[model samples]
Each structure stands twice: as structure tokens, then as C-alpha cells.
Target: MTAFDAAAEFDRQVRTLLDRGHPEAAGLTAAEFGALLAPLRETVTERGGAAVAVAPEEGRVPFVLVVTREVVPVERAVALTTLAGRTKPGVVDRHFADGDLIRFTPTKEVELPDAHAYVLFDVERGEEFCGAVPEDAMAAIADRGRTPLTIEEGIALVTQYPAALAKNKCFSLGGSRCGDRRVPAIWISQNAPKLGWCWAGNPHSWLGMASAAGRAAAGT
Candidate 1:
């Protein structure tokens, strides 16, 4: 199929899956996911699409998916911080890992499963995406007893989610310091920021305001 044909088929297939998953999806089945996304499969035959993750035993992710401007509906856990970037380019495997959170709000016609909900990010904030109870983002994770993602992995996961995040000017949400210095440095938007790519990684970290709030709430 042509690129347009492939894209259209992919969209149709995913929508069918979502529709089936929803009560309204009357005639959808998972068996056709491959047929729906058949065009992308050409990457393997022509463009050399393959696994390139950094390490076999690195983070929780086993592989990565790179869809440009395609908002795929993953479990809300997949979304980390607000507008986290995508995975690093040409790693052993990269999805949207730019050391940022993957932000989401409400966008239509993006990815499978449908709906937006702040998927992931490269930054560290309080309990924003994790909700009242911090749960793992990937729904495929059957093992709930696994150790919480390390800061590096957490950042990696959030960064994998595609969106836009800014990192130019520091967003100071005044609070404690990084250590025992009690420094007034918490990276949150000075103004009410919606869930989107607030900044791009320059100093390699987004100072999320939620971190301070979470710290204060924890009495740390």
C-alpha cells in the first residue's frame, strides 16, 4: 500500500481496536492489528527497522515505537511528566527518550485506544501523572512487585512519550533545595501551565513544580 494507504489503514485498524475495547466498538478484533499497521512493516524490509535499546537489562521497556504526530492511546501510566520528549534517536532502541516527561491533555485522532491523559515526561514532578496512588505507566506490566523505576529509567520513560517540552528559562516553584541547603529552587511553571511540552532539555532537566508540592506534602 502507499504511505497514505498505510497510514489510513493503520488508523482504521487502531480505531477498530479501540472501538472494540469500548462498548460502542461493535465489530472490532485484535487479530487485525497487524493488517491495519501493515504499511509500517515495510520499515523492517526496506528501512531496516530493528531493536536498538541501550541494554537488554536496562529499563522496563522492551522495545520502542516511533510514530510522528501520532497520538497513540496507552495506559495513562505511559505518560510521565507534562509533554515529555520522545526516546533518544538511534539508541539500541528509542521511542521518545529525551530525558523529559510526555505530556497529554485532550487531542483527537492520534493513536490507538484513544484519549489523552498526560502520558509521560523527562522531568520529575510530584504526584501529577501518577495520580493519588503512584502506579506504573505501562499496562502490560503484570509484575506489580518490580522495583520502582530508577530516576534514570523514570526520566527515560517520560522522555519516550512524544510531545513538546521547553527547558530554556527556569520555572522556579520556590521550595527546598536539592540537598540539605534549603535552597529556593523548585522547577515548576511560575504561571498556571497546561499539560504540554513546556520546555526542551537544555541543562538536561525540567524543574517540575509538582516536585516541591510533593516534597512539602511529604514533609521532607
Candidate 2:
């Protein structure tokens, strides 16, 4: 779509948020709101996604949303939040790995099914998207007594029993820490073991493997 068309769509989304009683939008004048959407509009046009404005609660500043077709990495999400001038931008999805966002908020305020259980803000999209895990799946994982696998365990599992990774839907969350920096992690889904090759023998090791695993799960 043309930049102009994208901007119009963004404006429409913002208006919808306002109509939904977003307090942050209530505070901003139309021009100010437009200014906030400017960067996001350009981003969506260049990147081919949608943008929205999330109203802040309890006196927080409103954020510009930058929606993408795939799950955004934590580092990239942080960068997007920084670019948008928010200390903590929201990064929402159906499933999240540890470190996908620095913090997570569980809210029933979102529109997606089972999203009321938990949601992450997309710093780039500036709003929540329809990717949060459904409530049934969360319950199933719990019922199966499945806990997040440690980095070592994940590596061992993939290395020793590669096929089992996909069959058992075994995946790891965020446990790999790289020095002082925390790499943004992604959820490991049914196809995790196949992702090992992406980080196999890499210096970052676990973190790379987890990142690749998340991408594969998200099909990004």
C-alpha cells in the first residue's frame, strides 16, 4: 500500500482506540496524536504491517503500535520502544518466550481470545496483536506438568533426540544469558529441534539456538 494509504489506516486504528475510551488518546489533541503516529505510519509503509496507538492507563503516555506478520525479537522490540520514546513499550503475542519483553502484563482488557490471561506489548507496533497463546493451550501445558526447559536441557534434548523435539513439541523459554546483555528469546514450538542447525556451533550457543527456535515456531 502507498504511504498515504497506510497513514490513513493508522489514523483509523488510532480513532478506534480513542472511541474505545483509551485515556491516553483522550489527553492528546488530534495534531499531537497525528505526530505520535507519524513514525509508525512510515514504519508500516516501509515494512508492510499495521500500526495502532495503545492508550495508557493510570497516567502513562500512549504508545504507537507497529504490527508485523511475525513475532518481533526482544532486542528489536526494545529498539522500537526506544525509538517511540517509551521506557517500556508493549509487545503482545499469543505465545512469548522469556526475555521477549523486559516485563509482561496480564490483562483481560485485550480483544484476542484468551488474551485476558496475559499479553505483551509490541514496541514496534505500539499495541497488542492477535498472537497471545489461547487459554486452553496454557492449561494443557500446565496439565502435562511441562515446565520451561533449561538452556542445557533444551540443548541436550535437541542434540540427543532431535526427532523427539518436534514430536513432543518440546521447546525452551528464555534461560540463556549472554554476559551482561540479555538476548531476547522466543517461544519454542513443535519444530524446535530442526532449528538447532541455525545456532549449532555458534559462539552465542544457547541464545542463538533459542532465537532460531522462536523464529521457527512463529514461522517468521
Candidate 3:
């Protein structure tokens, strides 16, 4: 498939997984999952590779860890990785630095490689991913004179709420990245670095490796 076609497919899979509403719905967070595959697509485009995820009519992901430089066919790309997972770590790790952007709910979290192992985020310099949203004085969205938003809406609305926005979901999960007790960590882009959540679409599918309960709640 073409790069745009692949991205569209990836986006569809994420939406499908999110729509499942399964609590185990906990899979890779939207950013994590998106970051994981986008780069592969880029590389594929550069190399003219057609390798991409086969549309999953079912829940199970038939294609995982696609790596190719381009000019390669999807079938060939798929078969090549089966030879050895040597390139897997580089792609995965590059996107998951402890300080990299991530998302998590009560079920699970998508942590970057360089993040704080104990905190599930980064703790270097002043940047840290507490992995939870801080409890601010604002009650609920309704309390703030607004309606409760869907995950996608919330992601968008949070951007304007200085007190409510975050770089990481660590704060939402109930934790403090720093001792300041001031602000929760923000979720940064895994690849883009400083960019934060745009919520271009809904994150109903935002999840990664979830626990049984999380899956149930997320409707996975």
C-alpha cells in the first residue's frame, strides 16, 4: 500500500480498537502506537516499500514491527522481519524514551524507553512524566461550566486548559513527576519532541498492552 494508504489503514485500526470500548482496550497509547508506525511508513516511502499492516478485519494484529527502507513490497517487508527481529528494538525504543510522550488510563500506559522506570516517565533535568493528571480545584468539566468531553474532545480541550493540560497522562493516573506538587508532566511527541497532543482525531483507541480489568473497562 502507499504511505497515505498505510496511514489511513493504521488510523482505522486504532479507531476500531478504540471503538471496541473494551477495558482491555488498553493497548498502545495513541501517541505510542502512532509513533511506532509513522516512522516505518516514512522509511517505506523513502525506499518505495509497499510493506504495511494488512487491514485487520479481526481484533488480532496480523502485522507487527514492519521495517523497510522503501522500494520493497509489503509482502517482502513482512517476510524480511520474520528473518530476524534485529530492527524491532531500534524502532520501538526510539519512540518510547522515558521522557517521550505517552498516554495511559486506569488500564495501562505507553511508556517511552528513556522514561523513569519507577515513574513510567522521564525524570531528567526538570522534565518528568508523573503519568497521571493532578487533581486541580476544578471539579469536572461540568463543574467548569462545560460538558464532559469524549477522549478525543478532552484531548483537544485540555490543550487550552493550562491547568488541565499535560505532557503525559502520568498525572491523570494519579502521581507526581516532581516534588513540586505544582504541575503534572506534559506528554511530548515521541518523534516530534516538543510538540504535544493535537488530538487530530479521537483517541478512543489509545492503549497498549493492557491488564484484564483495563481491557474490560476500555471495552477491549
Candidate 4:
């Protein structure tokens, strides 16, 4: 899609949130806000991606749009050790340090009950985990071979395993110089680093791995 199309879609998503009684999206009606998002739309389109809007369930924070990069197959297990310096220590680190091979299997193409979630496989342990999934559903999802994940599915995966993904180096931390304090920044491009919600200065904010990966994928 073109940048303008992305921006229009983003605007529609934001409007939907507002219609759903999300107070945080009130500010989005401003013209200045639209201007600010113009470049973001362009970035997302350039990277062959789309934008997904995430709203906090608490209705406290503003609705944010995350950009999704192009979908690419990760056929082989990516060694966690390779991400040492690029990523901070986390679940992936601990597992890799223990000599475990990490595999992220996409379940987007499968017609499963919970197609929205991605399956994270610990190859050594033969264990699989998905975020916000009930214990009963895990078995069913696992039975379905991990399918290819779309950019949106990848975002959902990040949302499900924020700490684990960040620690494993799936996402990097991004920061901007906010006066004397260097505060964590949001992702705008695929080449840029990703940050968890914990780094956004407002821990309560819901901008997590999903947003970060989405931003990076969009090459903002």
C-alpha cells in the first residue's frame, strides 16, 4: 500500500478505537497529529508492510499504531548466541546459554482456533509456549504444525512474550534524548531498534514488543 493509504488506514483504526470509547484517542483528531503520522505512513508503506493499532485495555494510554514489515520465512533455527551484544539477556539468553536452539514457528497460515498467536518452540525441551493462551488450548495449537506468520501475527507474538523476546534479542531497545534524561523511544523503522513497554518511561503503557517489531518491520 502507498504511504497515504497506510495513513488513511491508520486513521480509520484510530477512529474505531475512539468510537469504542477509548479516551486516549481523543487527541488524534488534531491536525498536527495527522501531520506527524504522515511520515510514519510513508515509512510503513516503503517497507511493504501495514500498520496495526493497539489500544490499552485499561483505557488510560493513547492508541498507538504499529507497523508490520514484510513477511519472510525463518526456516532454520536462529542461534540465540548470535544476538549477544545486540540484545539484552532474557529467556532466550538463558535458554541459549543452556545450549538450547530457539525456533519461532509461525501459525498464521493454519486454520486453528487460535490462529492469532505464534508458537515459540524450545527445540531442546520440546516445549511450546504462546501468550494469553489457556492451558487447555496449548495442546491443540501445538498439534497444528507451526505455520507461516504474517507481520500482524509477529506483532501478536511480541505482545505475548515481551520479556522473553526482548531478552532473547528479538527486539532491541530504542531511546531518544529527552532533555537530560534519555528516555526510551518508539520504533519507526525496521532498521531502528525496538523497545519494550518497560522502557517507554511509562511502564503502564502497552507499547511492547509487538509495537517494536512492527516499527522495525516497517523500516520507519
> In candidate 1, how many Å is residue 25 off?
11
State the lDDT at 159 in candidate 4: 32
Model 4: per-residue lDDT, tens digit, 1-220?
3223434544564343233322222233444433433444444334442223322222111123422212111111111112212432112222222221111222333332222112211111011221222222223333453222233333323332222333222421221112222222122223222321122233222222222222231223
Give the root-mean-square deviation of each candidate in angstroms.
Answer: 18.8, 18.4, 17.9, 17.2
Candidate whose lDDT is highest: 2
lDDT of 1 by residue, 81-189 (tens): 3343222221111322343222321112112221211111112332222222122221112132212222222222333422212343222211211222111211224
Instruction: Please count the clashing residue pairs in each candidate, in the order shown.
Output: 49, 19, 56, 7
Q: Candidate 2 lDDT (Cα, whole model)?
A: 0.28
Model 2 residue 78 CA deviation (Å) reads 24
Residue 111 displacement (Å), model 1: 18
TM-score of each: 0.23, 0.24, 0.19, 0.24
Candidate 3 Cα outliers beyond 4 Å, as residue runs: 1-4, 22-24, 27-47, 50-220
User: Which run of 10 residues does model 4 get worst, by summed lDDT?
Assistant: 72-81
- Per-residue lDDT, model 3, residue 111, is 22
Candidate 1 lDDT for residue 59? 19
